[model samples]
Target: MKLLTNRTRKMDVILIIVGAFIMAVGINLVYEPMDLVTGGFSGLAIIIKYFTKGFIHGGIPIWVSNILLNVPLFLAAFLLKGKKFVGKTLFATAVLSVALYIVPSFDIVYHDLLLASVFGGVIGGIGLGMVFITMASTGGTDMLGMIIHEFIPHYTIAQVIFVIDGAIVLLGAATFGLNKALYSVIAVYITAKVMDGMLEGLKFAKLTYIISDQYEEIAKEIMDKLDRGATGLHATGMYSNDEKKMIFCVVSKKEIIELKNIVGGIDPKAFIIVSDVREVLGEGFIEYKQ
Candidate 1:
């Protein structure tokens, strides 16, 4: 057990290092070159770096601006998520911010708009996705999403993130220009798509509940026809005050449509509820039984 845990820790460290490097390259080479503001602290940095002039510019550099924006987000993470999460996210963000600040001081790179936007989005997306895969976030709107999630459990973290990020982009457009804003949107779109790509195969299992009179037929059909496992849970109808079979099954996203169709055909009036499950460590879904 100790050996396995150590190995996992080592792998996480390696991923963080690589992910941070990719994020830095994207910011310094791609986004910075095109003068495009993205969705996170980096985006805020670009805007602040441009507007503040003379003494203010001299006092607060891009790196400082990034730190300023991230401080609040990091605080939120610490308060909401805990120290470990905040520490990791803050470490990652600091590394990225420092990288973005120092890289330009040493070297110059291509500033072409097309190349910058495409490569920046790709690298940034992959890095961010890697962070998410490790059950951590790089703070910013991600932290805000957690806070919102506490208030609104039904809405997803990603949805809340979108709302916050969209507003930030609009503000950037007003401060910078429409062109910068459009490019930022493109960068955000590409980043989100690539992040999804990175986590594509890590699909979660689904839990389906079907309440219907034809539960036996539906359950049998699901197990026999779809080769899926199911259980007949005892349930009572509140209005009818009568016992019924609640067909309960766990399946992957691929098997869901077939399961739903079978239940629908058997009993069109069936009540179906589906939810995304985090893990299912047993039988057909996982190798190890739990």
Candidate 2:
């Protein structure tokens, strides 16, 4: 148990570093240069840089704004949630700040809003996804979302974060103009999709419930041919008032056709319901990982 915990801790640190570095790269190279404010503290940092350019040299550095903006947030989280909850997030946020400071900025997009938006979205999405997979965040609105969820248990953390990020995007529009804001929206959407895909995985499967009188034969055929397992669930038909045997099975998407054919051949009148499963872990599927 101790070994597993230590291993997980080490892995989280590594992922946070990589995630933070990539996110900073997207900000410094594409988003910052193109003035595409997608949201979060990074977006706010860009606005700070813009507004302070007259007084500050090329505006306050993004890393400075990032750290300063997050200090209050981190304090709040630490007080409300405790160190255990804030520990990983604090580390990730600090790493992100350092990454922002050290990462060399070269305008890879050359002020091309379209290219900037897409590339920024993909890079930020993958980076954020990596951080999220470790159950940590780069602070800013991400931590704010978690704090908000403490008050609103009904909403998931991701949903709350989405709302917060959207508001920040609106702020970006106010600073960077609606044209840039619209393009930023595209980047934000892509980021969300890519992030969701990372966390949920790209693999899809089908779950089916089969009701038939010839359960024994159908189950045998499914096991023999499909090389899959099925379970018999006791169900009662309400109007008919009859006990029914429902076969429950989960199979790859490609196997759905053969499964249907097998059941249809044995019991033409068999009732089957197939549903989409986002992720399945176990034997004959993605093995459970630490």
Candidate 3:
């Protein structure tokens, strides 16, 4: 038990270091350079930076604003998730925020808005994805999303984040005018797409339910040729009122095409329904068996 606990702690520490590094790249490279405010506390900070630039007499910098905003979110995470998660998340957020401040002090490499926006969204999205992949997150509205999701399991984390960030964008639009705010929207969209691409992959997976007389052939082909697994269930067709065999399996985007080919070859009229699965858990997915 002690050994397992220690291993978990080690993994958490590694996650913190790697997550922090990736977040820094996103903030310094994409978000900051492009001045894109997606949403959340970070979005608020970006808005504050734009209007308040040089307005303060030795007041807190934009980076500090971001750190300060995260403080409450960190506390929320501690209360919501646990002390261990809060500690690691706080360390990572602080490191990334500090790194963002330091990295820019050296120089401004690109002044072109287009270049800055493109690079910033891409790099930042990758960093955000890396942090999320480690069973942890950068504390902010994301923590709030976790809290809300705990109570409302049906409420999506991504949608929760989108709403929070979208609110910030509205506020930014009000303060900064329509043009800059619109650009921020573009950056945010790009950031989201890039993040999803990195987290889920270029070719995402879909959950497919195949109902046909050729279950045995399809199952065998998937197991042997595709090197995948499938679950079979006994079902009765509503229209025909006849007993049917349903095969359920998850496959990547490319595999879906192959699966269609296999099914077509086996049974020209197989009832196949495909649905998008946002995240998958268990062996061959995100988590492995104990």
Candidate 4:
């Protein structure tokens, strides 16, 4: 157990570093060059860089702005949320800043706003997803969001983040232009979708709830034919006043059809509800140890 904990910590650190680098690549190579400010301190950094070009060399670097913007937030997080909440995040944010400093800026999209937004969003999403899986965050808007949520307990941190990032995007729009801002919205939406897919496993399965009097035969058929296990959930139908074992089974996408066929064949009048399972783990699924 101790070894596993150490391994997990190491993996988390590695992921934070690699993810932050990839995120930096997206920002410097595509988003920065194209002036597509999606959101976060990175977005603010781009705006600062653009404005300071005349006085400063390449304006203020993204890393500089990132660290600067995040400092007060980190302090606030430490004080408000305590050391435990801030430790992993502080390290992750530092790694992100280092990544932004090391990754070179380039015109990856050749000034194509559409291409820039799409590719940048995808890349950023992938990186964010990786960092998020570790149950840590790369400060910036994330920390700010959490801090803000402290004052308003009614609103969720996610809601506060949406508002903050939205304001930043609007600021970017004002600084850049309407057209670029519009493109940034697209990038933001894409980033969110990709990030969600990352958090939820990419490999999807079907979860079927079989409500039939003949659940035993159906469960057996599923186990034998699909090589999947089915759980019999104790459910009481209020309307019918009937207590029964509702069959609950999860199967791969391909196996879902066969499962349905078996249930349909066994009990034609059976009530079957099928839904998508983002991920399934254990036997015949994702091995958690790996």
Which candidate has the highest lDDT of all?
2
Encode model 4's per-residue lDDT on 201-267: one tens digit a residue. Answer: 5568898999999999999999998889999999999998889889998888888899989999999
Question: How do the residues 1-290 of candidate 1 rate in per-residue lDDT, one tens digit apiece?
Answer: 78877896677666766786677777766775566777776777766776776547443566777777777777667787788777667776776666666666311335456556666778888987777666566666756766677789887555566667777788788987898778778777778777766755455788999999888788889989988888989988899899988888999878889888898888889999999887676767755411
What does the lDDT read for residue 237 in candidate 2? 98
Model 3 over residues 14-122: C-alpha lDDT tens digits?
7666656665665655565555566666667767776676777533565788677876777667777788677667766776677667665321435555655566566
Model 2 ranges with Cα > 4 A deviation? 201-205, 212-214, 217-229, 235-244, 251-271, 278-290
Q: Is candidate 2 or candidate 4 better by lDDT?
A: 2
Scored against the true structure, residue 252 in model 3 reaches a CA lDDT of: 74
lDDT of each: 0.74, 0.89, 0.70, 0.85
Give model 2's clash tally: 0
lDDT of 3 at 187: 63
What is candidate 2's lDDT per residue for 1-290, written digit by digit as tens?
Answer: 89978998899899999999999999999988888888889989999999999998899999999988998998999898888768999899999999999998889987789998898999998998889888788999878877898899887566676677788889999988999999998888888777777876645899999999999999999999999999999999999999999999999999999999999999999999999998898999877765
Clashes, model 4: 0
lDDT over C-alpha atoms for residue 67 of model 2: 88
| Candidate 1, position 156, lDDT | 58
Clashing pairs in 3: 26-124, 30-120, 39-165
**Model 3 TM-score relative to the real fold:** 0.71
